[model samples]
Target: MKLNIQQETAQDFNAVFELNKLAFGQENEPKLVELLRKSSAFIPELSLVAWFQNQIVGHILFTKIKIVNNENDTESLALAPMAVLPEFQQKGIGGQLVNSGIEEAKELGYKSIIVLGHEHYYPKFGFEPAEKWNIKSPYDVPANVFMALELTPNGLENTSGLVVYPKEFDTV
Candidate 1:
Protein backbone atom coordinates (compact mmCIF):
# COMPACT_ATOMS: atom_id res chain seq x y z
CA MET A 1 0.00 0.00 0.00
CA LYS A 2 1.22 3.49 -0.80
CA LEU A 3 0.42 5.18 2.45
CA ASN A 4 0.84 8.86 3.20
CA ILE A 5 0.99 10.35 6.67
CA GLN A 6 0.40 14.07 6.95
CA GLN A 7 -0.69 16.75 9.37
CA GLU A 8 -4.44 17.10 9.51
CA THR A 9 -5.96 20.20 8.00
CA ALA A 10 -9.17 22.08 8.71
CA GLN A 11 -10.73 20.40 5.69
CA ASP A 12 -10.06 16.99 7.18
CA PHE A 13 -12.01 17.62 10.38
CA ASN A 14 -15.25 15.89 9.44
CA ALA A 15 -13.50 12.94 7.85
CA VAL A 16 -11.26 12.53 10.87
CA PHE A 17 -14.27 12.77 13.18
CA GLU A 18 -16.13 10.11 11.25
CA LEU A 19 -13.03 7.96 11.13
CA ASN A 20 -12.72 8.07 14.91
CA LYS A 21 -16.41 7.36 15.44
CA LEU A 22 -16.37 4.42 13.06
CA ALA A 23 -13.13 2.98 14.34
CA PHE A 24 -14.23 2.95 17.96
CA GLY A 25 -17.89 2.13 17.38
CA GLN A 26 -18.83 5.03 19.65
CA GLU A 27 -19.15 8.79 19.76
CA ASN A 28 -16.98 9.41 22.81
CA GLU A 29 -13.69 9.41 20.98
CA PRO A 30 -14.97 11.60 18.17
CA LYS A 31 -16.33 14.01 20.73
CA LEU A 32 -13.01 14.06 22.49
CA VAL A 33 -11.26 14.91 19.25
CA GLU A 34 -13.62 17.77 18.62
CA LEU A 35 -13.16 19.12 22.12
CA LEU A 36 -9.41 18.80 21.97
CA ARG A 37 -9.27 20.74 18.74
CA LYS A 38 -10.82 23.69 20.50
CA SER A 39 -8.79 23.38 23.67
CA SER A 40 -5.40 24.89 24.40
CA ALA A 41 -3.92 21.42 24.60
CA PHE A 42 -4.37 20.73 20.93
CA ILE A 43 -1.19 20.45 18.88
CA PRO A 44 -2.00 20.96 15.23
CA GLU A 45 1.31 19.58 14.08
CA LEU A 46 0.84 16.38 15.99
CA SER A 47 -2.67 15.77 14.72
CA LEU A 48 -1.91 13.37 11.89
CA VAL A 49 -3.91 11.18 9.56
CA ALA A 50 -2.96 8.27 7.37
CA TRP A 51 -4.07 8.15 3.78
CA PHE A 52 -4.19 5.41 1.20
CA GLN A 53 -5.30 6.04 -2.35
CA ASN A 54 -6.67 9.43 -1.35
CA GLN A 55 -8.87 8.16 1.43
CA ILE A 56 -8.22 8.68 5.12
CA VAL A 57 -7.59 5.35 6.85
CA GLY A 58 -6.25 6.28 10.26
CA HIS A 59 -5.78 9.15 12.72
CA ILE A 60 -3.73 9.99 15.84
CA LEU A 61 -3.50 12.99 18.13
CA PHE A 62 -0.97 14.29 20.63
CA THR A 63 -1.88 17.09 23.00
CA LYS A 64 -0.32 19.13 25.78
CA ILE A 65 -0.31 17.71 29.29
CA LYS A 66 1.56 18.37 32.49
CA ILE A 67 3.24 16.40 35.22
CA VAL A 68 3.14 18.13 38.56
CA ASN A 69 5.11 17.33 41.63
CA ASN A 70 5.82 19.10 44.90
CA GLU A 71 8.83 20.80 43.39
CA ASN A 72 7.80 21.75 39.87
CA ASP A 73 5.55 21.11 36.90
CA THR A 74 6.85 19.64 33.68
CA GLU A 75 5.29 19.95 30.24
CA SER A 76 4.65 16.77 28.33
CA LEU A 77 2.54 15.30 25.55
CA ALA A 78 -0.40 12.93 25.67
CA LEU A 79 -1.45 10.52 22.93
CA ALA A 80 -5.09 9.71 22.77
CA PRO A 81 -7.93 8.24 20.73
CA MET A 82 -5.83 6.74 17.95
CA ALA A 83 -8.12 5.13 15.47
CA VAL A 84 -8.16 3.43 12.08
CA LEU A 85 -11.08 2.40 9.96
CA PRO A 86 -12.15 -1.10 10.84
CA GLU A 87 -11.32 -2.34 7.38
CA PHE A 88 -7.83 -0.88 7.75
CA GLN A 89 -7.12 -1.99 11.31
CA GLN A 90 -4.66 -4.81 10.69
CA LYS A 91 -2.97 -3.26 7.71
CA GLY A 92 -0.46 -1.20 9.77
CA ILE A 93 -2.22 2.12 9.31
CA GLY A 94 -2.43 2.69 13.06
CA GLY A 95 1.23 1.87 13.46
CA GLN A 96 2.10 4.33 10.76
CA LEU A 97 0.10 7.03 12.52
CA VAL A 98 1.90 6.37 15.80
CA ASN A 99 5.37 6.33 14.24
CA SER A 100 4.71 9.51 12.33
CA GLY A 101 3.19 11.21 15.35
CA ILE A 102 6.23 10.40 17.46
CA GLU A 103 8.64 11.82 14.90
CA GLU A 104 6.57 14.98 14.63
CA ALA A 105 6.45 15.38 18.41
CA LYS A 106 10.22 15.00 18.60
CA GLU A 107 10.74 17.64 15.98
CA LEU A 108 8.42 19.94 17.87
CA GLY A 109 10.55 19.52 21.01
CA TYR A 110 8.21 17.44 23.15
CA LYS A 111 10.18 15.35 25.60
CA SER A 112 7.73 12.69 26.70
CA ILE A 113 4.35 11.20 25.80
CA ILE A 114 1.72 9.43 27.84
CA VAL A 115 -0.96 7.06 26.63
CA LEU A 116 -3.73 4.89 27.97
CA GLY A 117 -3.91 2.01 25.53
CA HIS A 118 -3.25 -1.59 24.80
CA GLU A 119 -0.33 -3.00 26.76
CA HIS A 120 0.78 -5.22 23.92
CA TYR A 121 0.41 -2.70 21.14
CA TYR A 122 2.16 0.34 22.67
CA PRO A 123 5.22 -1.50 23.91
CA LYS A 124 6.35 -1.99 20.33
CA PHE A 125 6.69 1.77 20.08
CA GLY A 126 8.91 1.82 23.19
CA PHE A 127 6.10 2.81 25.59
CA GLU A 128 6.51 1.36 29.04
CA PRO A 129 4.51 1.47 32.25
CA ALA A 130 4.23 5.10 33.34
CA GLU A 131 5.05 3.98 36.80
CA LYS A 132 8.60 3.38 35.71
CA TRP A 133 8.98 7.12 35.78
CA ASN A 134 6.69 7.48 38.81
CA ILE A 135 4.02 9.07 36.67
CA LYS A 136 0.37 8.28 37.26
CA SER A 137 -2.66 8.75 35.09
CA PRO A 138 -5.55 10.83 36.37
CA TYR A 139 -7.92 8.08 35.39
CA ASP A 140 -7.82 4.89 37.33
CA VAL A 141 -6.66 2.20 34.92
CA PRO A 142 -4.44 -0.82 34.92
CA ALA A 143 -0.82 0.14 35.31
CA ASN A 144 0.26 -1.70 32.21
CA VAL A 145 -2.31 0.02 30.00
CA PHE A 146 -1.18 3.51 31.06
CA MET A 147 2.22 3.91 29.48
CA ALA A 148 4.80 6.58 28.65
CA LEU A 149 7.57 7.10 26.12
CA GLU A 150 10.59 9.35 26.34
CA LEU A 151 11.27 11.31 23.18
CA THR A 152 14.74 12.37 24.34
CA PRO A 153 17.49 10.69 26.25
CA ASN A 154 16.58 10.61 29.96
CA GLY A 155 13.56 12.67 29.13
CA LEU A 156 11.55 11.18 31.96
CA GLU A 157 14.33 10.44 34.36
CA ASN A 158 13.38 11.27 37.97
CA THR A 159 10.08 12.72 36.86
CA SER A 160 7.34 11.68 39.26
CA GLY A 161 3.94 13.24 39.51
CA LEU A 162 0.25 13.26 38.62
CA VAL A 163 -0.70 13.72 35.01
CA VAL A 164 -3.00 16.68 34.32
CA TYR A 165 -5.09 16.22 31.21
CA PRO A 166 -7.29 18.77 29.58
CA LYS A 167 -10.79 19.22 30.92
CA GLU A 168 -12.19 17.74 27.71
CA PHE A 169 -10.74 14.34 28.48
CA ASP A 170 -12.80 14.07 31.64
CA THR A 171 -15.90 13.50 29.58
CA VAL A 172 -14.52 10.42 27.96
Candidate 2:
Protein backbone atom coordinates (compact mmCIF):
# COMPACT_ATOMS: atom_id res chain seq x y z
CA MET A 1 0.00 0.00 0.00
CA LYS A 2 1.24 3.50 -0.82
CA LEU A 3 1.51 5.75 2.24
CA ASN A 4 1.24 9.52 2.10
CA ILE A 5 3.19 11.50 4.68
CA GLN A 6 2.29 15.12 5.19
CA GLN A 7 2.80 17.91 7.66
CA GLU A 8 0.03 17.73 10.22
CA THR A 9 -2.43 20.57 10.16
CA ALA A 10 -5.21 21.78 12.46
CA GLN A 11 -7.76 19.61 10.67
CA ASP A 12 -5.83 16.53 11.69
CA PHE A 13 -5.97 17.20 15.45
CA ASN A 14 -8.89 14.92 16.33
CA ALA A 15 -7.84 12.17 13.97
CA VAL A 16 -4.31 12.21 15.28
CA PHE A 17 -5.55 11.88 18.86
CA GLU A 18 -7.81 8.96 17.97
CA LEU A 19 -5.03 7.24 16.07
CA ASN A 20 -2.62 7.62 19.01
CA LYS A 21 -5.18 6.19 21.43
CA LEU A 22 -5.80 3.18 19.22
CA ALA A 23 -2.15 2.63 18.44
CA PHE A 24 -0.79 2.86 21.97
CA GLY A 25 -4.03 1.68 23.63
CA GLN A 26 -4.72 4.29 26.31
CA GLU A 27 -1.17 4.97 27.36
CA ASN A 28 0.33 8.30 28.39
CA GLU A 29 1.34 8.73 24.77
CA PRO A 30 -1.93 10.32 23.75
CA LYS A 31 -1.88 12.81 26.59
CA LEU A 32 1.73 13.64 25.97
CA VAL A 33 0.97 14.27 22.31
CA GLU A 34 -1.66 16.80 23.27
CA LEU A 35 0.70 18.50 25.65
CA LEU A 36 3.45 18.59 23.07
CA ARG A 37 1.18 20.34 20.61
CA LYS A 38 0.65 23.18 23.04
CA SER A 39 4.26 23.30 24.15
CA SER A 40 6.35 26.07 22.68
CA ALA A 41 8.93 23.55 21.57
CA PHE A 42 6.70 21.88 19.00
CA ILE A 43 8.00 22.19 15.46
CA PRO A 44 4.96 22.26 13.16
CA GLU A 45 6.70 20.52 10.31
CA LEU A 46 8.12 17.88 12.65
CA SER A 47 4.65 16.82 13.67
CA LEU A 48 3.64 14.50 10.82
CA VAL A 49 0.66 12.41 9.82
CA ALA A 50 0.24 9.46 7.53
CA TRP A 51 -2.98 9.52 5.55
CA PHE A 52 -4.80 7.13 3.28
CA GLN A 53 -8.24 7.66 1.81
CA ASN A 54 -8.48 10.88 3.79
CA GLN A 55 -8.01 9.15 7.13
CA ILE A 56 -5.03 9.62 9.40
CA VAL A 57 -3.51 6.24 10.17
CA GLY A 58 -0.23 7.20 11.80
CA HIS A 59 1.36 10.07 13.73
CA ILE A 60 4.90 10.95 14.80
CA LEU A 61 6.11 13.83 16.96
CA PHE A 62 9.59 15.14 17.71
CA THR A 63 9.62 17.72 20.42
CA LYS A 64 12.59 19.73 21.68
CA ILE A 65 14.31 17.87 24.52
CA LYS A 66 17.44 18.72 26.46
CA ILE A 67 20.32 16.63 27.69
CA VAL A 68 22.19 18.06 30.70
CA ASN A 69 25.83 17.11 30.86
CA ASN A 70 28.19 16.75 33.81
CA GLU A 71 29.21 20.31 33.11
CA ASN A 72 25.50 21.17 33.50
CA ASP A 73 25.14 22.07 29.87
CA THR A 74 22.16 20.73 27.89
CA GLU A 75 21.63 19.25 24.44
CA SER A 76 18.26 18.94 22.68
CA LEU A 77 15.78 16.63 20.88
CA ALA A 78 14.54 13.42 22.43
CA LEU A 79 12.20 11.69 19.94
CA ALA A 80 9.33 9.88 21.55
CA PRO A 81 5.68 8.90 21.38
CA MET A 82 5.56 7.71 17.79
CA ALA A 83 2.44 5.66 16.98
CA VAL A 84 0.66 3.84 14.16
CA LEU A 85 -3.00 2.76 14.30
CA PRO A 86 -3.46 -0.73 15.73
CA GLU A 87 -4.73 -2.23 12.52
CA PHE A 88 -1.73 -0.76 10.76
CA GLN A 89 0.78 -2.32 13.14
CA GLN A 90 3.51 -4.52 11.62
CA LYS A 91 2.83 -2.95 8.29
CA GLY A 92 5.36 -0.43 6.98
CA ILE A 93 3.38 2.65 8.05
CA GLY A 94 5.37 3.12 11.24
CA GLY A 95 8.58 2.79 9.30
CA GLN A 96 7.40 5.33 6.78
CA LEU A 97 6.47 7.84 9.47
CA VAL A 98 9.83 7.37 11.16
CA ASN A 99 11.77 7.68 7.94
CA SER A 100 9.83 10.77 6.94
CA GLY A 101 10.39 12.35 10.33
CA ILE A 102 14.10 11.61 10.16
CA GLU A 103 14.32 13.16 6.74
CA GLU A 104 12.55 16.24 8.01
CA ALA A 105 15.05 16.41 10.87
CA LYS A 106 17.92 16.22 8.40
CA GLU A 107 16.54 18.99 6.22
CA LEU A 108 16.11 21.20 9.27
CA GLY A 109 19.74 20.54 10.26
CA TYR A 110 18.96 18.90 13.58
CA LYS A 111 22.05 16.95 14.46
CA SER A 112 20.64 14.02 16.42
CA ILE A 113 17.50 12.21 17.57
CA ILE A 114 16.99 10.28 20.77
CA VAL A 115 14.32 7.64 21.36
CA LEU A 116 13.40 5.25 24.13
CA GLY A 117 11.83 2.46 22.12
CA HIS A 118 12.10 -1.18 21.13
CA GLU A 119 15.69 -2.33 20.81
CA HIS A 120 15.01 -4.47 17.77
CA TYR A 121 12.70 -2.10 15.96
CA TYR A 122 14.75 1.15 15.98
CA PRO A 123 18.18 -0.01 14.96
CA LYS A 124 16.84 -0.60 11.45
CA PHE A 125 16.73 3.21 11.32
CA GLY A 126 20.38 3.55 12.48
CA PHE A 127 19.62 4.24 16.16
CA GLU A 128 22.08 3.00 18.72
CA PRO A 129 22.30 3.54 22.46
CA ALA A 130 22.55 7.22 23.35
CA GLU A 131 25.03 6.21 26.01
CA LYS A 132 27.44 5.36 23.23
CA TRP A 133 27.43 9.05 22.50
CA ASN A 134 27.66 9.91 26.21
CA ILE A 135 23.97 10.84 26.15
CA LYS A 136 21.41 9.67 28.74
CA SER A 137 17.71 9.91 29.38
CA PRO A 138 16.10 11.33 32.54
CA TYR A 139 14.22 8.10 33.11
CA ASP A 140 15.75 4.78 33.90
CA VAL A 141 15.38 2.41 30.98
CA PRO A 142 17.32 -0.45 29.51
CA ALA A 143 20.47 0.64 27.75
CA ASN A 144 19.24 -0.64 24.43
CA VAL A 145 15.87 1.02 24.86
CA PHE A 146 17.38 4.52 25.03
CA MET A 147 18.71 5.03 21.55
CA ALA A 148 20.16 7.87 19.49
CA LEU A 149 20.78 8.51 15.81
CA GLU A 150 23.07 11.14 14.34
CA LEU A 151 21.68 12.66 11.17
CA THR A 152 25.28 13.52 10.49
CA PRO A 153 28.36 11.71 11.79
CA ASN A 154 29.70 12.90 15.15
CA GLY A 155 26.42 14.59 15.80
CA LEU A 156 26.72 13.75 19.47
CA GLU A 157 30.48 13.87 19.82
CA ASN A 158 30.41 16.93 22.03
CA THR A 159 27.00 16.12 23.44
CA SER A 160 27.29 14.32 26.75
CA GLY A 161 24.30 14.85 28.99
CA LEU A 162 20.91 13.84 30.43
CA VAL A 163 18.10 14.12 27.91
CA VAL A 164 15.27 16.27 29.21
CA TYR A 165 11.92 16.66 27.51
CA PRO A 166 10.11 19.95 27.81
CA LYS A 167 8.50 21.11 31.07
CA GLU A 168 5.11 20.07 29.73
CA PHE A 169 6.32 16.50 29.75
CA ASP A 170 7.07 16.78 33.44
CA THR A 171 3.41 17.52 34.17
CA VAL A 172 2.24 14.45 32.27
lDDT of every predicted structure (CA atoms):
0.93, 0.85
Q: Per-residue lDDT for 25-109 in model 2, tens only?
A: 7857788888888988899989999987777889999988777766765455667678888887888998999999999999998
Candidate 1 has a TM-score of: 0.98
lDDT of 1 by residue, 1-172 (tens): 5799999999999999999999889999999999999999999999998889889988999999999999999999999989999988898888888999999999999899999999999999999999998999888899999999999999998889999999999998
For candidate 2, the per-residue lDDT at 43 reads: 91
What's the TM-score of each model vs. the native?
0.98, 0.94
Stretches of candidate 1 exceeding 4 Å from the true structure: none
Summed backbone clashes in each candidate are: 0, 3
lDDT score for residue 16 of model 1: 96
Candidate whose lDDT is highest: 1
Ten residues in a row with the worst lDDT in model 2?
Answer: 69-78
